[model samples]
Target: MPNSEFSGCRWAVVLLVMAAASPSWAAPIEQSDTPLPADCDGLKKLSLPLEDAPPASMASSLKGCSSEDLYFGIGVPKDPVRARQCAYVERQDPDNGWPNLFAGTGMLMTIYANGIGAPRNFDIAMKFACELGGAPAEEEGWLAHLQKLKNENWQGQDFSPCDDITSGAAMGFCEAHGAKLASAARKAKLADITAHWPSAERKAFAALEKAKNTYAAAVADNEVDMSGTARGALSIAAREAEDEQFLATLEKVISGNLPSVSPPDLAETDNKLNALYSKIQKKKDTSDWGTVTKAGIKKTERTWLIYRDAFVSFAKRNFPSVAPESLKRVLTEDRIKSLENFGN
Candidate 1:
């Protein structure tokens, strides 16, 4: 058999075992309450101010400029003639006017920090940072920029110092401002995705419902031995329904076959199943069917852990190697300093 097919079968077995063993009440562990990092306080105080405007004529010429322009403008090649042409175009099209100077300035600061146009030049970096610190309109732009950073495809990037620095800076700035911003953004995105989830959820529910019906029929016919696969399939279907995105995509595939079920209803069903699994596992009788189910669930959990570890190992292996000294200074030294200065 093909390797891919073998892997798929292996994963199915793993999932089946985990689902059987998992306690109905097995919820994700919550994080412990740790004190906020000390350097976090100082980093919070670091604000970017906007620098003075360009010459009146130059500013006019940049009228129709955009965030993209601002991104390219700072330290980008300047052609007075082309800029004049752009200004003329801006005069003709008011709706597509150039990006606000402050927004552009913020964008420039981001670009510099990200090392987009140049190598890691801390001098220019400090300049733009100081500019952002001074700019009044920079707050909104900076916040929006940070959101963009959060949404960045980090896994796809080459992962250079330039890119990573901007990411770290964006994260630090967001944290300094308030970690709530990141949390709120994540929640908002999740909400948006969940809002349109009815169809996907309905489809998942139908699949589970079908599985349940099938199992019930098997039991009625006294075919208990043949019901294991159906029960396993039901567990998988129910779990898939709980995954907002997966359900949404699956809904498309089984469009007309979906039942009229909401996400909340599906969620409740999942919770009930989890609780049932937990109850079964707690039973003392080792020779009972509940024990067999619990064992299968344990196997599933182990398989999931193995799968997770494999991906993590793959990521670690593929990650680009950076200079040890650079890593130590950037990741460790700066963090240590930030912590040391936090309360002071």
Candidate 2:
């Protein structure tokens, strides 16, 4: 048989074995027609081993206990009887040890998938998976188990057990593995952002664009060259047409609206903008432009800061007012902390 086919067969056999061993199949719980015990203590005592007790009697004995308690071994046999009282108890109360078995199985499966239990052994993996009782485990329980596996196996390595297996039994495993992969992908993305030259170039270009837009608007409106700064800023703005195009392309990428520009085109744009800025700065006479130029620059800087502050203020002010007071307080405090951090 092909390797893939053999693996598939192996999984099928494993599943079959698990199904056969499950308590629901091997030792089904019984429902009784008899009346229940009076209270919790009576229920507990009544559930204890009873010689030749019918399935109905066993069920009646557990009447007042919660399902959780019933499943937790409330009326278990501590000794054997010639009439097979223990056997009856086991048959009628298969779930007596289910919670512990479920937990152990979950833990074992996680260790196997993560390779933490026996890192180099496929045999151990198979063994652990088999012991997990084959597939009736709850999805959430399995998920939690896989998360624990991920935490154990995350040692500068990215291993995903979910990708290799797909069974209802492994749903939790897949979810946890997917979550880890997503986290890794996010970190990779953030790294890409840090190394990217375009964002920095875009910021510089945006500063120039804002200066140009303000100067152009002032000129159009016939506002005083009250800040002689306008002419020099206009000169810098004129040199930024190529940068403006590059910034437009980057903005599209940052906003997830389009593909990124080619690296060569980006490099060429960066060089061109740097050269233009250098030339403009060399020609700019900050000393001779008079207070108007200084005033205009200061005003532009103030406008940007105001815009930033307003956004933070808006976020805090419009936060869900209907939320619990404690939640609102936390949100308000966190916002204030963030603003302080930004200022620092």
Candidate 3:
């Protein structure tokens, strides 16, 4: 891979400032090597995982990968060197079923694109992205665009696909792409767990999934204010969390490890929620309410109540022994926390 940092300087700025007096190519600026082929052969030339490594599916490519964790600083200090090393190790692994090759290469793309631990190299980043592949026409079109730039001998640094992500909508789209990758892993695991279920059970699970999705959408739209640029990203993040929680709750149910609660416990939680709701409604004129108004709070509470009932109904279908009251209590407690944290 190209190791030159000479291209990292503000060469474009310098040229622009002197453009009126000097010719377009007057400066002896170094040109990047011709764009690499957007193919596995070009990917291998980067010397990352291997030269002969086979292409892998993009599904579940980012789930539970060390490179992802290191690069994103999830539960550990971010270390770009280790991140790159882990990515290389993952890609070279013989097991294609696990999220390995694409995960590694994808992380490398992010690392180079963002200059996490090295000079930003869009050339290397583009090469990594091409290896991921996509619908044939779209993939070819993207490569063609890049090739055009190379052929024209564009003096400016090559652009990464992520270069123009300046707004919430753009970031949200980026997160949506990542969510699709992560969702693949969750779907795979769910399939494995439910492979032996009866038709009735499968049908019930489908209903539960539909209910969960409805509730998730409600939560994203109602719980989070949509007035800011990050609203898109924030709303997506909320829905993603709901997806994860759905899978996790199912796993717990299958394992018979779901917590149990009694009627009294449910009543107490409901009482607390009611008290908090009344207080907030009466204090709507206070500055402590922040951006949320009394009407909005009422609407959110109504939405939450519907979600709580749907959750309980779903839980009862899959795990009859599990108390519906327990689910209600837990959901109410979650609402309580959300209310308590309003001004904090």
Candidate 4:
């Protein structure tokens, strides 16, 4: 497999939304007339660490909770789940066409071809890799690997019944538990990392903290021009790009400080959402639609996507200067809870 097998079989998504009660916004890090460290090396000089990570844990440092394993366990090399997932994430940014950037989809295809967590299917792997855009060399290698897995007659696996949380009450409880657990985990993680920080990186650590504080202040000051235009979008994109870089620096430093800490699996959050969505489909599929057209189910899904995008976009306009991924995530998390539990 070139990198598509889902280890822990769970994915992680990081939505960086500004959380503030105030409506004022501003540029947190004042860009110097002399462009300060734009790349990791430059940023490293600034004492800020950064790493290239895959989006949504598709092939990532971020881990997802698995109902099967019940947890996205640590110990990457030893853990079957972690090893498989880590395989999906390649370290070659130059090959991916994005300088210093990891290819999210390319890694996924690798997993499929290698049969990391799922079945070894060359056709499926190639299909996904093509969709994700790729370097041809990866595809050829993946093809060969899939053939190898096939020769061994490697079997595939699916999520066990325990992995599927169908009950509304159960899922809801799980979400609450997840939220609480995440909060504690984050606090502990931050404390643990800081405690272990070496003196050489103290300046870098302070800079990172200042960046975080300023970003928070900016998010709070949201009283900015909400005009939606190409120019505004570009401006937002620029700032968001900076924010992403700042975040990457933080990730790198933390990894440096504490090599043992693993990214979250976020199974609780995902399971609830997946179950609710599945229930909706099952209900629609088995429904006695009466006057409602059978096409309504799929239409509803499509419409929901459109609505979600628009709604998030609008909410994001208020800030117009930061990434709305976090807002989208919060909204998404809330939505699963609000969804009509068909299984109930």
TM-score of each: 0.21, 0.22, 0.51, 0.21
lDDT of 3 at 152: 60
Question: How many pairs in model 3 have backbone atoms within 3 A of each other, for residues 3 or more apart or on separate chains, i.e. clashes?
Answer: 0
In candidate 1, stretches whose alpha carbon ends up further than 4 angstroms from where it belongs are 1-106, 113-122, 134-344
Distance from true position, residue 141, model 2, in Å? 19
Best by TM-score: 3
| TM-score result, candidate 2 | 0.22
Give the C-alpha miss distance for residue 199 in model 4, angstroms: 21
The TM-score, computed over Cα atoms with residue i paired to residue i, of candidate 1 is 0.21
- Per-candidate Cα lDDT values, in order, are 0.32, 0.33, 0.55, 0.36
Q: Write the per-residue lDDT of candidate 4 for residues 207-261, one digit (tens) a residue.
A: 4455444542332122112232222222233234334443443444333331221
Best by lDDT: 3
lDDT of 3: 0.55
TM-score of 3: 0.51
Give the Å shift of residue 122 in candidate 4: 3.9
Comparing 2 and 4 on lDDT, the stronger one:
4
Sort by lDDT, top down from the best: 3, 4, 2, 1
lDDT winner between 1 and 3, please give it. 3
